[model samples]
Target: MPTVALHHESIRLHTPLPTAFGEIRERDLLIFELTGADGVTGRGEAAPLTPYDGVPLDVCAEALAVYASILQSYDDDAPGVLMLDACREAADIPVALAAVDLALWDRAGRRAGRPVASLLTDEPLDAVPVNATIGAVDRQSAASAAAAARDAGYSCIKLKVGVGDDAGRVAAVRAAAGPQMLLRLDANGAWDVEQAVRAIEVLSPAGLEFVEEPVHGLQALRAVRERVAARVSMDETAEDMGALIAGGADAVCLKISRCGGIAGLLAQAALVRSGGAEVYVASTFDGPLGIAAGVHVAAALRVQAACGLATLEALDIDVPEALRVRGGMIRVPTGPGLGV
Candidate 1:
């Protein structure tokens, strides 16, 4: 699986998915074709479960344009290697490179007659917990969305924040979802350290599981961690192992697309989760391709906290899923590669 080709998709979503951290306007799909010497093609996507993580749709096309030449050198059997090389050269935007990398893996999976999960050397399908994410614009919306998730059989729910109504919004979601559900929030770097502290205090009494990036920047993040009630996890801030270690993050948020590939994301998970930092394998509102990648990584690891995998409830279509959640426990995708 050495060579590569590109494709695109237009997906219509229900509405803009919102949370304390960020919002998704819509998610376009991307395809990567990894061709073998025999001319088989494998397809994969790189979009996050949600459209946050700072990856604008236009940036992906730009990434393809810039790295077109270097990617052409590799043959089909080397889809993984070809993608790795591109990632090394185009380090600034791993999300774009992820499309190529996963597509290569998908192609290689086809060549080997296995799913993406089977091709991963590090994974054999470990079980994990999954939380359903509900995207709503305000507390009223949050509350309504939470009820829908509860009805859908999700045990835990995560809401987005970053705007001013943080406390009331959480209250609305919590009240609607009821007390039995575990709640999480994502702020999308909307507050300063001081404001983050005040905001968390307002909501923590309701029993939050954790908070994702209440403030922006690495330094400000650590400062807010000192002040807030909910434990802080790094999402947009921790792109790689170096950043994860350097940022002093208590929890490392692993999104497959943002990490560039499942293989690399698994590597970072080993370093961060094994070292006692909280590791959550989640997605960025990516298409099914990206969701499968994150599911593979999370499915392979032993994660305690329920993941943000619930974000997929909002996607227009489904990708490969490694596991499903029931009563809060996440199931591991059972198969050769990540095609579960």
Candidate 2:
């Protein structure tokens, strides 16, 4: 059996990130460290932003306490069995379960002396393409940020829409990023079905890669996706796999915490692809450990779409330099475990 320990930390963003949900200026993250009997330790992060994902930090903490107690008595050598047992304990709290899943995977990879991606897949990518996120909503600010991202060697950019003047900001960003660059928008389910259709139709001419969560619920997403020529991707509305497979959108956005960690992410990715939709990884302003875990998963999958993992730069805290985005790509950490 392994011992589990928990730590809490608060981090502030360099600037407030404005989205359709609300403004995020800071984050309280929970880190879980799992140490095997052999004295090897693995790390994971649970970042819950109530305004973003609606999961509270205290609730995750309480779940972790329950998981910690269960892990203390359970003895399983097989990684799969260990994960299943751990997940059963924190099944209700996916965010907290994510921490345990991550730690287990990290410990497994470290024990095997391989990177987590290699442990998941036989062919892991050396680097994964990533997208720069622009938080600015106004035309001038959005255009300026888009231009900066272009100058910084980003080939893809994601902007938050359904906030204010969606058309103006989209047009501004398109012009600044040039016609060749891939441009995507996230509405955070802020609009109604009619509003989402209208917004997507109005913004399609600017060459949108996709519109994410334009409206809440699978049925509404399907309605909007059916009417518009532009592609639609589900984010917050993707929790229901049964409804998601019913063909609401062209793609789905997944996060580490939301998916319950790498193992769950792999399962969801398969489900998304089996339903004939694309799956891409994103972050919820997670700390370095969480972001690193996302990178490894994306690398193993070799997803075509640029992932939304280039978000660590938004935080004021220092992360591993290796996790930094370069040339519009994130290089997979090559060391054992998460390598960060």
Candidate 3:
């Protein structure tokens, strides 16, 4: 059993965009490499996801460094050894660890000649529904995007909130999307508790499905949830698998980069089901690797809700056909080890 070495890559989106006030040009993906004693190689990628909690590049570089720095002291050939499980649970480090951890799992699945899904979540699901992401744009643009997503077959839609005219913007989208679309909101913890409650109260009438991370951290999250009418979800405050389950969250936005990796995601899925709550595995606007890993988890888990899968389009790539959305749903990959 030779060790698996974790690696990373930095790639620009092949394009750039301004959404909701920020410019995203590139992304950091966690790629894991497993080298067996006989020299066989296997690979998996962690979703280089960004959060409201930390700087994107800094988080990824720090994650890669954990593997690199430890390899200097820990043998490269002996994998999964001599590390405290809770090595760094501060905020975003778990996501970094998750990227490497998932890649290793991908490597293992490939080496075993089994599909990552079968090894973990079974076969491809019929379809994992999609929720279109409406970014930080004005009402007209956001409405156009949401309508486009609906035309693309998406049944649910998510809006990035907490900017100006918070209620007005959400209401515009809801009105344009009509009364049937499953509407979700992510404030990225930008709104204060009072602001969050007011926004949710105003939007709930427009058929808001859920609002994520209206305020920062667990305590504030709890307070908002207690007071607000909207179903409060945990996005930024969820760090580890433990936090994903125990942060007193109603639902968690599971990002592969947050928990550790594919293996770490599996660990979190277990936590989600065990906690008797729902999980919405989202994209950190990551590339294909993290998205694939998340697809596997979404398929395996008892997720009845739509996931944040529409974000994948923001990053350009020819994704696997199995992962492509049709009728607003994407099926999990059934081929061996995240096959392209």
Candidate 4:
């Protein structure tokens, strides 16, 4: 039989992470460790961002405990199968199941002496480009941040909008970044159909790469996309394949915790791609371990667009073995499992 252990930690952010939902000053992470009879261990993390992830911390913790108890009765011969069963049973707790799903993948990779990316796909990418996020700020501050990000070698920058003079902020960022930089915007579902259409129209001249979750529902999303010239990407509204396909957005953002895990993400990605839409891998301000899992997923999918994985800097403390970013790119971990 396999044993599971869970640990909880709260990390204080050096700088308050701002989003359209609110400012986040701290993050709570639940780490899980699964030890097999052979003495080999695997690790996973569950960090739920409230309002955004839908699942509360207390709820995820409870679900994880339930998952662990259920897994103990299963044979240790196939940890992956056990994880799948647990995930199916705890389908309501997607984030908690994601933690176990990743941990089991880690265990399997270690046992096979191959990286998780290798297991997911045969065509592994060397690295994935990351987008530097400019949190909601005033026009001047947004411009300065955009300039700094460009100077730091980040070719892609994601600007948070839907708060205070959004059009002006977009213009300032575009001016600072110039035409060469890939600029994207995330409204975090702060706008209505009218507001989203107006905002997208006003900021369309900035040459945005795409706008994410500008409005709430699938109907509103389609309306905004129809009214605006810029491409639309769905995040908050993309809960399932049906929603993603019906949302009519050009792209859908995939977060491992929200999508169940690597397996779930791959399935969604395939569905979205088959429908002539693109897929982007994003994060929930997770710690290093969770971020590493995202990196492997991005590599396995051979993502061509910039991903939202350059968020480790938002955390005050990171795992020592976290993946490193350079020249706006994060190198894929080559070691067995989720290397970091």
C-alpha-based local distance difference test score of model 4: 0.85
What is each predicted model's overall lDDT from 0 to 1? 0.69, 0.87, 0.68, 0.85
Model 2 agreement with the true structure over 35-58: per-residue lDDT tens digits: 878888888888887887778888
1-340, model 3: which lDDT tens digit per residue?
5455655666666446444335568776666565556665556565544534354666666665666444335433445424324334323365566655555566566667776777764444645777887765678877787778777877898888866666767878877777788998887877777877777887788787888778877777888888876788887677633566664567888777666666666667677668766787887776676777777777767467898875666666665576677877777766667654
lDDT of 4 by residue, 46-152 (tens): 88988687788998899888888877776667648655775567656778878888888888888888889999889989898999998857889899989988888
Better of 3 and 4 by TM-score: 4
**Higher-scoring candidate on TM-score, 1 or 3:** 1
Candidate maximizing lDDT:
2
Ranking of all candidate structures by their TM-score, best first: 2, 4, 1, 3
lDDT of 4 at 112: 86
Mark the 10 consecutive residues where model 2 has the least summed lDDT. Answer: 78-87
Instruction: Please give the TM-score that candidate 1 achieves against the real structure.
Output: 0.84
Candidate 1 local lDDT, residue 14: 66
Per-candidate Cα RMSD to the true structure, in Å, reads 3.3, 1.3, 3.9, 1.5
TM of each candidate vs. truth: 0.84, 0.97, 0.83, 0.96
Top candidate on TM-score is 2
Give residue 221's lDDT in candidate 3 (0 to 100): 85
Model 1 misplaced stretches (Cα beyond 4 Å)? 1-3, 19-23, 48-59, 65-71, 90-92, 121-123, 126-128, 240-242, 318-336
Put the candidates in lDDT order, highest first: 2, 4, 1, 3
